[model samples]
Target chain A: MLDTILSFFKKKESSKDVAKERLKLVLIHDRSNVSPQFLEMVKGEIIKVIQNYMEIDEESLDIQLTKTNSEDGERMVPALVANIPIKGMKNAGR
Target chain B: MGEVIVITSGKGGVGKTTTTANLGTGLAVQGKKVVLIDTDIGLRNLDVVMGLENRIVYDLVDVIEGTCRLKQALIKDKRYEGLHLLPAPQTRDKNAVTPEQMLKLCDELKEEFDYILIDCPAGIEQGFKNAIAGADKAFVITTPEVSAVRDADRIIGLLEAHEIRKPRLIVNRVRADMVKRGDMMSIEDIIDILAIDLIGVVPDDENIIISTNRGEPAVIDGKSMAGQAYRNITNRLMGQDVPIMDLNVSEGLLSKMKKLLGFKTA
Candidate 1:
């Protein structure tokens, strides 16, 4: 009964899904010719600019190279998606 | 004027040569005059795959170097009166022919044949450039694997960069059983990633190996499923509107019996 319950709670992901996800991630970097260091630099710059206006949780900051529908929705294009947690905004006087 | 179509894959061993041989023969079977050129110099395989290796007297390098006339280098296939092959030089490398020479040669071939299918060397190198330089379009071939698909994407990008716009995709060696079990990538998954128009999807059939072993294309064998797939592709290439073959339809009683008996069904 315990094993059945445990199995029920575990999500089964198809290997093809895993392959698709991995291909999408790798192709994003390949198409843009962007390295991990380049992404790191971009993340640092973005954080610096955002930090000037608000306090952010650097530890929780997540940046990824991904794909999204183009403006016309005709095709998929490479996109840089970032999720940064905001602690608080800076004082207006400062 | 004949259309020069280059069959290419970014990675090796994805059946680029096989696809070329099959499609070339398929076109010839349709009564269109076709000539296949092997651009993979020093590693020529199209001739062997077509079962015409022993008949090669002159090669692409010989024609380009003016050592032999263009007509003298082309080996006509006795099986198909409309088909011929220009084998690559076994001793030379890809550097033997330049893009200009290839372009000129393609122009010369355009007057005689209805289709010129260039079996491209794998990878984005001088051989690839030479192969595509004279072509009007391209067909990027890949198997249903991550590495092949990734390399295919790279090849597509390179083809577009070289002004070969909107190259069609041929996803080869697909295993329908694995796809049904979610263990293999489907045609939809590959098309979703590549985002190119699909010309055809060839199922993984053991007949391809058997046919290659005999130095004949799977397309020549009417009983082979892969051969039927190539026939469909050939029709599509000729502006015919044949629907893609339904690979799942074969999973009937025979296959079920094979599965029950623990036998591998092609």
Candidate 2:
């Protein structure tokens, strides 16, 4: 049937996968007891500190709470991952 | 002493009362003396679900306030030999009974019954506190939906905070067909996220509604899939390692026919 042929070309990612990904992200923040506002405040402070040493792109800065394996790789732990794009380095002898 | 078990779900309408009714009845069916205490206070309905609404002469409030003896408030279910129900007062709110009172009541009931099942009200409030006050074990019920599971996670945190460690989870209203189609979350997916021991998974079935309408629990019906699921849960509660029921066996005829025609159902 045409439907069966079309199905072969369709995206394989199901909604349940999307739900799992979303739940993982939400639960990480929930378990870590960090609110979006709290993360934003922390980001602002980090930006302020980073600006003292280097020029960074605040618009494209990405910060989020995610899960990462622990040192022993036996447990998953909450991690604060941040991507701060450095534009330029500030003068050292200012 | 009898074990006090609290049935709780953070979200409303996730089958907490129904689970309580069926499990309590199922335990009695297995020759265990059981008592189900509805702790929803003003929104009490376990009595109706058990078909004991008209027999409630005295309620939990009466026993707590010393208006009646504990023995006077316990309603014996004629259908089940060892089953009894302590209905909540229809007129009173959650404040009518305190955690201390509930603890005392559970202590008294433990002396008489083999299993004391408390049906906890929804939300993390006074009702929830009172229901879990005397529970030696807790069963956290949840559906596959995101909101219900999120609330259940919060409840698990609260239960551990209250020293009710490692509360087992019961996932209700699971649709096997939906899970097969990758649309609904499966039991494994829910358990992975919640990170709790799975006690049981009940498929969504019309028999639950039919039994509720008749003021009788589905556990009494031999043919109902949900009833068989409850029987399995009861066996697990009694320390028997019963395997989880295979939900796919009850697939609808249309799906079976579709598969027969060589069509991809999922």
Candidate 3:
């Protein structure tokens, strides 16, 4: 109910905004030369590794290939960043 | 030395050839000796666009292949004393001429012409490589659409990799009415994403199609809005600071309705 009220107050995104957002995401993948399927595979592996020790919120996990400026600000380097949320640790009750 | 400028757009049907034809004519009108090279092999249209298709006895491939001299293949435009065209061979594919050959050709033409404008073929392939091979500068042409802009970004990345730094952009076929309504991407929006220096923004005009069909580039028509835009771009290219065209169509439906209802608007 609160989210709906806040969203109603927010300005509607134009088609240009949607295009820019989509292009930004697609370009990140293109510049890194990483396929979406490959990213999904990597995400699956990461989730499997974490599942061995902890209970993770799979729905909240986010992984993406992005860019960062080099130390001297001369070059843009592609970086793979991931965020995985944890709900609880396995065997905590034991 | 002459400046070899490649008009390239990664996606097809964006107006690279039209820009090439207009810029060639525009620069020549400014008393600059200009030569337009059609590098889009297997799909040659520059000659047709320039209305010099019937005069092609020899082509770029023939010059490179040593069958004909460079001068023999260059078709002189009837209107301009300085403007010339080295058309692509419609029969041959892109593999017919190599990048090294294109570089040598540009070197030879540099001595005679003030500007050598190469019309690049679509896609990042061998044809594209050959087009940019001899170019000192590149003008990326793209529309306001998402796909064209995305392709332009990719082309820009490739240009950077080839060490062709400081590429300028030409935003082509922009609809003023659509932009006013936020239905189309504005020049500012495109420039913000592309992160390149803007040379000019050409407004979408119906007259361009008419002029193109007649094989006379719109830049020659003083009455054309698109022609004025091209002329401004030409002046800008010659190192003059020309103002961008005001693309706001003032007498739109809203204004008409307001006028009918007697509501004065600013």
Each prediction's whole-model lDDT (CA) = 0.88, 0.88, 0.86
Instruction: Give the lowest summed-lDDT range of ten residues in model 2 chain B.
Output: B257-266
Report the C-alpha displacement of residue B72, candidate 3, in angstroms.
Answer: 0.6
Better of 1 and 3 by TM-score: 3
TM-score of chain B of each: 0.93, 0.93, 0.93
Positional deviation of residue B79's Cα in model 3 after best superposition, in angstroms: 1.1
Local accuracy of candidate 2 as per-residue lDDT tens digits, B142-197: 99888899889989988998999879889899888888888888777787798878
lDDT of model number 1: 0.88
Candidate 1, residues B201-234, lDDT tens digits: the string is 7999999999999998999898999999999889
B1-266 in candidate 3: lDDT tens per residue? 89899999999999999999999999999999999999999999999999999999999999999999888999999898899999999999889989999999999899889999999999999999999998899999999998999899899989988889988899999998787777787777777788887888898889989998999999989999999999988988898766666776454533432233221210
Q: What is the lDDT of residue A21 in candidate 3?
A: 65
What is the two-chain DockQ of model 2? 0.41
Give DockQ per model, in order: 0.45, 0.41, 0.35
Using DockQ as the measure, name the better of candidate 1 and candidate 3.
1
Q: Name every residue pair that clashes in candidate 3.
A: none
Provide TM-scores for the models.
Answer: 0.79, 0.78, 0.79
TM-score of 2: 0.78
User: Candidate 2: where is the Cα deviation over 4 Å?
Assistant: A1-11, A34-94, B249-266
Looking at candidate 2 chain A, the ten consecutive residues that score lowest on lDDT are A2-11
Instruction: Give me the candidate number with maximum TM-score.
Output: 3
Chain A fold similarity by TM-score, each prediction: 0.62, 0.63, 0.55
